[model samples]
Target: MSALTGTTRLARLVLRRDRIRLAIWILGTPLLGYALAGSVASIYPGQEARLGYATTSASSLVARAFNGPIHGTDLGAVVVAETYVTLALIVALLSTFAVTRHTRQNEETGRAELLGANVVGRYAPLTAALLVIVAANTLAAVLLAVALAGAGLPLAGSVAAAAAIGGVGVAFTAIAAVTAQLSVTARGANALAAATVGLAFVLRAAGDVLGEQSADGTRVRSAWPSWISPLGWGNQVRAFDGERWWVLALPVALLLVGVALAYALAERRDQGAGLIAPRRGPATAAPRLLSPAGLAWRMQRGTLLGWAVGVAVLGFSMGIAGDEFNDMIDANPAAAEAINAMGGGADLINAYLAAMLGLFALTIGAYVVQALLRVRGDEADGVLEAALATAVSRTRWLGTQVLAATLGAVALLLVAGVTTGLGYGIVTGDPLGQAVELGGAALLRLPALLVIAGVVTAIFGLLPRWSVVLSWTALLVFLLLGQLGAVLELPQAALNVSPYTHVPAVPAVDPAALPLVVLAAVAAALLAVGVAAFRHRDVPS
Candidate 1:
């Protein structure tokens, strides 16, 4: 039998298994583009208005770093400026997760092994996963091009942008395949792949920031940095600036390189093994490991470290750019107006900081949910039954895990505040005051974070089977409303559905404690009910 003999069957099986998942990922970017295109057109109103906004943005340090060069003053280009970077990230992440799920994840769960024992070929799983991603990404590109054109953008530019966006997905899909062959477990593979995506973002940002126009409007380091990164290549598509069709060639080359490397690595490894060896564990358990809480900490410590480092780096990087961003805004009245408008027009830095703080809390909330969901995985693996066979009650066993997650959240929250503040302080020479102010901003998110944790806890206790899907969906909803809804000018009632809507935007508002109290009360109620439910449920419940 050939190594790819069963690839077509496996590819169909993958599509069948992930039909809904694939549809959701493919449709999402187009919908987001539509919403953003409509909003930018409506909000900016006229050509002069849009151009002025672009000029000021092009001159700002932070804007350029985050959004890349504004190719033109046209609304279509403005849409690219605002949505391309965000959309690229979404597609890359979707590609990464999809490939990981079908490849390394299936292997870890023993599904691939079972299939291998049958008629499947050696390379069928990987070949099938790649084919599925290619089809899905192509579908997404066509949909987004149509959606953008429908939203009143130039058809050619829209199609070009969609291709560029899809290119990001293709490149990441291949990268994930490479990562899948390198790590011993799905979790390790995902961590490595996610870190690569993040580094791509950083490289793009650094390249763009260094390349922003000088005071007199001359170009500066952008070409070298951008040329080195696939994410940056998407921006070079320059959709509205006569469309740089050649830039689309870059990701194609990367896809070939990544695919070749992944295939080579996969061929060298066994069905259930990876090119990288696993780390050795200690021969004996420490005293702390004897307790459930200690065990929970041990399980989650590595995850916490990764999140901590990533967030800290982001905060510090933002801080480093703060002074230049503010100074540029001050020098350009048009830029200041736009920045103020986006931030509700008061202490732009603080307002921006507060928004980031809230979003960071959401990231921590996501961590909390992931930590709790691990319990479900353990239960399914019969780890829960084995542990429960001892003195550990279900409540005690789960409670320790919950407590560990909460502590991790608190730690992340603090880190976000300190790093952002430290960055701002270094720029403004007001370290102490910045720390106090920004640290308080982090504290303000406690209630909302707790609410998310409690709601996820209830889902886990009451609906373990649906916990993973429902919990993640809740976070996605909140993110869409808070980030994209504001841009789309969504109805106030719809926006109010997110708990973060009520969390004071800080520095913009003094932040009332009543809302916090009510949110905490709600969280407590949910947690209590969940605990009670778990108490009466069967083992593995």
Candidate 2:
């Protein structure tokens, strides 16, 4: 058989392994697009309202940088410009991670070694992964097209929009295939791919912002910087405006080039190894590594640092944007109602900051859960058994993981608060107090965040097999209720399911001590129950 043979069989294997993930990516992307479209349709129902939104969005440097360059005055065009970049980013990131994980990560973990000993060809795994990602992207495109068209968008525009979004996934999947060859570890490969995606976003934002003429008193050109990023290229496709189909050619061409380079590099490297190998550590273990908590800290510290940095960046950016937000509200009367609806008045900026922090806290909660679950994962992988055979007790082992989760979440929230405060202080010229206050506000949400981690732990202890799904399901429900319940006209009881709802919107509104205390109490109870159950149950065989 040829070196490239059995690609089809490998593709089937990839699909089997990633069935749930593929379903989530394929279905989630378009569903989110449809929901956003529905939201826009509701929020700006009239042409005049849509035009005003378009005008404001186009005028705002931050908005354009985050979204894409506005193409036309039409409502459809406005929606396309506002929503496409975000959707494309999600799709691209998913595809890139999917490809990298299945290809390089599997190989690194030794799963590919067993497969390779079979009929699998040299390039079969990579090719299969690409095919699976491509298929998933295509499904997303089809679903998006149908969803948009069902929502009464012009069929041609819908098709174009879907294609543009899918094209982004295809492009990034190929890029990740290349990165996979270069990086030695799965984490490094994933990071490289994610960084590339972030760079593309930044470049696209720069190009869009620089190329546009400032609608306000400033003189900024908006379209030039967008030309720099693949995301920009996708947006420039302008799904609704006169259909610039050729814009897709850029991503497609780059994908092909990336695949070729990755293939060549793959051939040059040894199986199960990257061009770069991990650096060796000291022969003796550090004194800190000897402790259960220290080992947990070592394993989770890098992830916590990364999360903290991301939250800080987000917080800082939102803070800087606060001034712009106020300026925009002052400049546009139409936006006043929308701003008021989001959070009332001159303090709206603070409200926005609080809401952003709350949402990020949810993500940090997920991070904490995953970190804690690393202990469960270790047990499943037999790593915990070996450790337990050593000097560690069940209490000490589990306590280390839980402590890491709890502490990590708190650290992340503090980072976000401090970053926001610093940025707000810089803009408003009150550096010291804002940072302190915002940081305090961020801390108030900790009870709710911890409650989420506790819930995950309880599930992990009581129903280990279903823990991850249950945890994520709870998060999804909470997110849906907190974010969309009002728009969807859901009931108050339903909205209250999210612990976030109880945490008073800080900075804008005074912190409500009652809810914070209640959440903390519930968190403590859940943790106790989880630990008790864990003590009683036998570790899984």
Assess each prediction's global lDDT (C-alpha) against the native: 0.81, 0.79
Tens-digit lDDT track of model 1 for 204-292: 88888777464534222265677777799888888876788998888888888888898899889998898899999899989998789
Query: What TM-scores do the predictions have?
Result: 0.91, 0.91
Give the backbone clash total of model 2.
14
Question: Model 1, poorest ten-residue lDDT window?
Answer: 212-221
Best by lDDT: 1
Displacement of the residue 301 alpha carbon in candidate 1, Å: 1.8
Writing each residue's lDDT as its tens digit, candidate 2 over 1-541 gives: 7877889988998888778777777787778788778766666667666666666667776777777777665556766875897798778888888888788888877888998889878888999999889889999999999998887788989998999998888889889999999888877898889888989888888787777554542223446666767787777777777888888888788888988999899999998788877888999999998889888888988888778777887788777777777655555454455444333225767667776677677778778777877877787767888888898887778877888888888888888888888888898999779889989988887888878878888888898876766776677677666655555557889988888778877877877789989998998898888888887887865
State residue 263's C-alpha deviation in candidate 1, in Å.
2.5
- Worst ten-residue run, lDDT, model 2? 213-222
- What would you estimate as the lDDT of candidate 2? 0.79
TM-score, cand. 1:
0.91
